[model samples]
Target: MSVIEEERVRGGVFKDINAEDEDQQPTVIESLCMTCYENGSTRLLLTKIPFFKEIIISSFTCPHCNWTNTEIQSAGRIQEQGVLYTLQVKTKEDMNREVVKSDSASTRIPQLDFEIPAFTQNGSLSTIEGLLDRAVAGLEQDQPIRKATDPVVAEKIEEFIQRLKKLKEVEKEFTLIIDDPSGNSFIENPFAPQKDMALTVAHYKRTPEHNAALGIEVEEEENDEKPGSDLDTMRNEVLVFNTNCPECNAPANTNMKLMILYVVNCEIWRSHRRAGNQNNLTDPSDMSRDLLKSETCSVLIPELEFELGMAALGGKFTTLEGLLKDIKDLIVSKNPFMCGDSSTADRAEKLELFGQKIDKIIAGEMDVHIILDDPAGNSYLQNVYAPDPDPEMKIEKYTRTFEQNEDLGLNDMKTEGYAEK
Candidate 1:
């Protein structure tokens, strides 16, 4: 009879490990929004794409009514380690006056509800399978049970199998369900959630008695600031306009209306519309009309508003022609362009170059539009050359030949022959 030695695995069995010890907690993901205001209403829109394992938080504050709101959304997954979540909230209020109806004044207000969705990620079964393989190996190596007669070995095997089954069931793949606050479910991609999920299971080699002796505490740091503060800083850094008071000749409050108009024209409108050349007019006539149209443009100061009329042909025009005049006027008014003031002179000189370019466009020498807006809302300048028309003019001449007979009407006595002489 051949005697075979039973190989003993040194590592601990499945019963020795704890599943909770191997599990990892979920993490929060953040998403931020880009915001803007137009008319009397504010708009907040998402700027970046959200992914699994991250969260997004966006907030907006209305300058007109002092109303504020915030939105948050989550990004899912980090590794096979943690899940992600997100939240968003919004608030709005009306800022209008009351209207008189018959004998009473009634106020109308609007209400708005702001809500965003929640995101999640669940881990895969492969992770559990890995844990099970390790646990099973440990169990088989810890005890050598070749015979069913051994009660002690039989009991250990049974227990190992039971734990393995439990782990297998728990480790099956799970899906994350995302929904808005209103209970509406969001669609998952490819017939499933787009986010990747994973689970981290903790394995403790020691007994529960020994594991209880350890203590763990995790603290996360906080670093969030008010949303509108940055915007406020940007607003403050922008330049504002000031002019002398016509009445007292003293420096008056900065013209807020004009400043706002400047800001809108220089910053917002130009930026949005991609207006190319700042100095070039698409249609000189229309340009003049726009300059004088009070309704077309509005200047808003804190408490005052300026309704400027359109630009006229002669009155301090700032159109291309006006700009040229302004440049000349500035040179004369300051007398610095001709002197040793090289910087002032340089600006004035550039204005002349610009004026020449504009003249060429107007003279039909250039084929391209003199002014255009870039995608970034900055003006662009371009020059195009076109051929002149034909010089010689064509003319046509006509001559007529007629035949006539000389004869008297009622009393024609002698017939006269009037031949061509």
Candidate 2:
């Protein structure tokens, strides 16, 4: 390519420019300002990122409308992958870690039920506290919040704010989880678990639902390259909530299925007969109504089916490998039922075969789904804004009817052995 030399200086500078080759300045391109539609107000800057990759950071300020906009675009080919970064905020020092969250990153505080879902804001580089503060600002500035008719929701949000403030003020501990499909988001941890760092980072496959929201599905489709499989449009996303067990009223499990219980046998339902005896503060007939309140939710696995029985994996699992390990331990090794199955050894061989298939699923050699039917309504899969949640996350709620309640022994006879009210 021929080099263009511009000599605007005097004779001495002109000779110098003509004598030696000068490094070409980054070509700044001008365009119609996106904000105010003015010519030459917008400037596009090209810069090299780490690894010698080129990228354009565009900035524009409109003098007429006082509008300003800035965006970063990769000039080189972008890598396609997903990432998850988790930080355990133990003290004030841990909260000071720098966080670079892309606009597509989804942030969640699992303990708080707080998630700043994807596509809600622009990319940002901030501290843990700053992210929390940004969430507070976003919640406060939301238009629906100001016009809300439901006092309960508004009150709950206020409570959430207080909890966030307490997270910084007090020495409260919580996990900060961030996920990004474009793989640009990060937490300022050691990025290695064996390094004995307090942080744990896991990278996993991105869901088509996530891609659709970020406009990634369309871009790759136009390129005639398959981004991924065409995800089931019926439900592209599902929220699996971690709730107390409805049967035993125990908080021991999340992402559990009644089907797993049938494997050996479930003890929860039998334990439910004594549920009212534990705490019968309300009228027997009235307290039974709580069993009727139902909500919908589904667990999103995007890549593999989670077939595990973890008493310890907790609520949020950002990757399939971590989840698979916990599950593999439960099925292949443990007598999770707590029952004396050792007295009968006829099923040992069958169990081994079943575990082998499970290993295949985790190894990505095979794909299958396991369904969890939680009757307690403790879990949910909400799609308030998403058009398609995820197909594998099909959730069905079963509420006990009055007849079913009667069969459970909430009959006309009270403790006094008389007709009930």
User: How accurate locally, in lDDT, is each candidate?
Assistant: 0.27, 0.48
Superposed by TM-score, candidate 1 places the C-alpha of residue 393 at a distance from the truth, in angstroms, of: 32
TM-score of candidate 1 to 2 decimals: 0.17
TM-score, structure 2 vs. true: 0.38
> Mind giving the per-residue lDDT tens digits that candidate 1 earns over 1-421?
1121111011111111122333322223332323334223323222111111123333455455565444433322112111121211111100010100110111111111111111221111112233244336545654555344587776767675665545345443322212222111112111010111221111112223322322222344543535675544654464556553321223345533212322233333222232222232344442222121111121111111111111111122133334334333432333222223122454446545544544554444533322221222222122221143212211112221121011101122222332334
Q: Relative to the unseen true structure, what is the C-alpha lDDT of residue 298 in candidate 2, on a scale of 0 to 100?
A: 21
- Superposition error at 81 for model 1 (Å): 49
Candidate 1 Cα misplacement greater than 4 A, ranges: 1-250, 255-320, 327-335, 340-369, 372-421
After superposition, the stretches of candidate 2 with alpha carbons farther than 4 Å from their true spots are 1-77, 143-152, 190-196, 214-421
Poorest lDDT segment (10 consecutive residues) of candidate 1: 91-100
State every prediction's TM-score relative to the real structure: 0.17, 0.38
As for model 1, its CA RMSD to the true structure in angstroms is 36.8
